[model samples]
Target chain A: MSHPTLQELRDQLGCLEETQRRFSRTIPIADAVDRWMPHGGLPVGCIHEVKGASVASALAFSSILSARIAGEQGNIVYIAPDRSLHPLGLLPYGVRLDRLLLVSARRSQDIAWATMEALRCSQVSAVMAILDSADLTSSRRLQLAAESSGATGFLLGPVTSAPIAAPITRWKVSSHVGKPGQRFDEPAWALDLLYCRGGRPGSWTIEWREQRLNTLFNQLATQTTREALAG
Target chain B: MARRFLSLFCPDVTDDRLTQLVEWCDRYSPLAAADGSDGIILDITGCIHLFGGEDKLFLDLQRRFHRMGIQSQGAIADTWGIAWALARYGEQSIVHGGNAASALALLPVEALRLPYEIVLELRRLGLSTISAVRKIPRSSLAARFGSTLLWRLDRIFQQAEEPLTPWRPAAPYRASRILAEPISTVSAVEYVLHDLLQEICKRLERNRLGSRHMDLACYRLDGTVDRCEIRTSKPTRSIPHLMRLFEGVLETLKSGFGFETFVLSVLDVEALHPTQLSLSQANPVEDESSFNALVDRFGMKLGFDQVNRIRVRESYLPEQAVEFRSAAVSPIAGAEWPAYRIRPVRLIHPPMSIKISILIPGGSPVRFFIGERQRRIVRLEGPERLTAEWWRDSNSRWGTRDYYRIEDDQGLRFWIFRDSSEHWFLHGHFA
Candidate 1:
């Protein structure tokens, strides 16, 4: 082959880096999420922001994600400042209450510190911090700690207009009232992928019943059709 | 290599003062106790050499007491009785191993520690000295004094045993240090604590033991003792882990005039067989690794109560259905909650009352207002009646309730109940 131009060589190097990132360790949460993510699932050793209109909605989603990240041998540490999280509700999500450590701290700084400490532990597979607010500095510190121990972290808080930190992914989940006639069905959530680094962002309506996530739409098929159309 | 005993006679001192002296004398020997009301007994069998000899140790103790404005006379002998008798009556402070009989013969009959009546009776019988009493037959002494005189004689002559109950139980594992210059800063205190932790951990390792509870006592120059204690979920002897637990406590320690002495005592220990260090730490449970350390850190930073593990109990009441236990004190076993009625993930404790307006009287609520905010219900699925647990409390105000799981128009699910008094309250959320 002819000698590659400088710009072409740079593009090839960038493509190699993207490929390497795609192979990073991840925890597959659902088929739709896995197919849409560049890494095939939620990336480990990084922070994911989960914001919602209600505290309970954000908490419900975080608890489900925490349970999945903390597999059979790992533990989940939840730093809850308000102490409002009910572990009984987590039973339906298949979270082992025994391996779940609940730390009730009143101050936001204390919550952040406890979250970082839990994230640094190799035995802890995930840490979820439910606090009022966090800054860029604390977020970066949590990111570094999680990366060092290969533990995933979730910051669950209320939706705010202010830009806080650039996490690996940002998701906004709100309650989805099913079609008017199907209002009595299982709990459904309107999940919006607001931001995803190196991956395409998409929205989907999913339902949680019998301890599994069921997508309301055929996201995989729709994604393929869109890719073909773009090509 | 016979055991040595030391006795000190403190004159004109109150009981509290004597107790303090007994505690202070722990520096000389571990087995130190208050003798009656006026004296202290110390089993300094193997501890005398630490101070360079029995004579120097005795003098040092007396000099320290004198400096503290207390009058004290001390003596060391082969037995506590001899030491007590000599320290109170005899001028000699140190008695050699042998010559027990000769030493006893020179003292008065009262040296036997007999009742006042018996001493007077011996004196009246012309037995003024121990030698004179010894000359009489032992059976006669027992018959005259009712075995009290013989017991005293046997104790002094080393024929009987008298164990000293220490001021405080001597911890099996202990390490202490007396700084030449008192330390006041946090760094200095931590440094001393570091040394003490190493020393205690070494002893624990030597005996294949691990400490479950540890206490650090800082004896200040102002004569006040400040102590901090830590309890672990599992027995451990790791120096770094133990040091981390003490880090928070050291900040709150008041080094009034500075801490002159530091003592680390392992109050509780259990058998901990040494395990071979593995090259790969694949097993977290067996390692007792970072997870426990994390618990300990959180326990220290926040109150131990703040770090909790939740467990479900056998109860119908939602709040009572789950219990939060401190992870520092109890081991968390795998939780297998029983299948029960559907429960909300977030429980609003002390449920808030709401105003509800229904289209049809006594029918399902169409809308409810919490404060000024209103929420419209789109679907309803309840009327599950729950009666008050009469056995729990006879005077409970909650007589009965009809619970309903209602989904608002916005898709938010709420568990609400109407009491017998016709009041609606929002209890939980199914978010």
Candidate 2:
């Protein structure tokens, strides 16, 4: 019949609040790529969009993100609806299939639903949802679910001509041709910062080499004019 | 003697899939139990010899489950706690007995399930591996690392006892057959079922026991499996009784293209004491086992959810009431009703908001607007006020709720509630 003590009340409140705080919040990634992301880390409870000109470029972008997030301990849930990805192809990029969970959803809507469910788990570090054809309502629902779960989602889709409102940072990727007469020429990649929160919107051309993307914008401009004149 | 164990960690399990995984693990070993959020502890113990040695047994398990399309990783060790630790943290398989100590030498001290902050502190002190921490003095380790860590480490190293609560008791009799050629026809299935029944009956007769329940599992060629189980009203080892129970179930098997193997296991067997037979009841005309088999077939054909049992809980709160669980898994044995507080049958998913006009000491509501219709309250029950758990951020803005079971003029009863200040909402209805 007596009122509960102050310490008892504090204990009850702590017990109720402990469930949400039980999740591990560390962003598992390699030290090198972790330095490039904002806050020196990928922001939790947000979405990152990867817009690519071709399927190959979209896959490459996803592989890079997957390798970065799935560095040592944490795992990546790749929800692929459009294409079947070979696990061996991603190994060289540092994504171990043992640590990577591939969920093949039949429909685009199911991918979003599964992604929402995957994000709720504290064990999953990041989710790569290949949104081949997602409408605005489903995309909004995904964004809300990602926010609630405190997990980051990478929305990978084709580059549409029409501009769409994205929830987080959007990067456009395109393949570039390499220089001639080079035995081990670098793989070219052009990245456009289409949309970013409080970040600069600029373009950067990079060549994939030695487990890192090297900037080749200044070097490519001079060679382009000579090739144009020769043609 | 060397003891072998298998620990499974499946982290991708959602809220709905956890029950299925638990049941699936029960098929492999009776000692299986849930570990944390996404792990299963299995006690292989003396059963490893059945599938050959430990390595071959692990491979056989992996291949069988892989064929079933469920991804899993397993580790074997000398102790239950160590097996649990290595399955989640170790890079390679930790072999049991001989190499357990060497295998555990390279693992991090956090594998002992110590607090995260303590592990961080250990890392900061450059004490990263289990071997490194083992070098410290026992007294110092006990003082600095806390008694819980020491106890867990001792349990893992086999210096302490750690027993497992098994999923089911060990069954005494079991029979299995591996087909040289996969059989697809119903007659072939019946032939195999008869062979299995004969084998089981011989074993039971030698032991002088009768089975209460039996399980039949058909491992198909295409990796899908079908299971048909039957429970008897009394202890039975009769071949005719068993064959009749499996009669109708054989027609429903798809064969999944065809079955490569079949296994039959009997459980809950009791010693059969001979008694004088009555003439009227000798070999009863119709057995209850056949009736149960028919219900099982119908339930499997219609869907598992078609058969259900009502489960009641002990609570004064109405919404904490009763729930219906599948008859196959519900813990309620023999459908005995327990004494519980009466509660309304109908409950809304999300309580609907309503506008109300108060008439008393400005307390209780006389009338309320529910959707487009207005209803007048005839009598009001006692108000039971409840508050939300404010510690949850999702419910931070939730106010206090006062509930009342009200009767309307149309003789419809509603469980309505008012908020901390006087706002009303229709929470549920009485059936």
Report every candidate's CA lDDT. 0.80, 0.63
The segments of candidate 2 whose C-alpha lies over 4 angstroms from its true place after superposition are A1-231, B13-22, B25-28, B65-71, B91-94, B178-185, B219-225, B252-261, B274-431
Per-residue CA lDDT of model 1 for A100-179, tens digit only, reads 89999998789878988888888898888885665788777877888888888888877863434867888888887765
Q: Best candidate per lDDT, number?
A: 1
lDDT of 1 by residue, B117-179 (tens): 999999999999988998989988878878888888888888999777898888888788977
* Per-residue lDDT over B208-265 for candidate 2, one digit per residue giving the tens place of the 0 to 100 score: 8877778877876544457787765446677776777677577878886788777788
Worst 10 residues of 2 chain B by lDDT: B334-343
Q: lDDT tens digits, residues A16-114, model 2?
A: 855223222424323432333333434556677877775445556556666666578766767665323433334445555445555555665666666
**Residue B253 of candidate 2: its Cα lDDT?**
84
Top-TM-score candidate index: 1
Model 1 interface DockQ: 0.51
lDDT of 2 at A99: 56
- The prediction achieving the highest DockQ against the true structure is 1
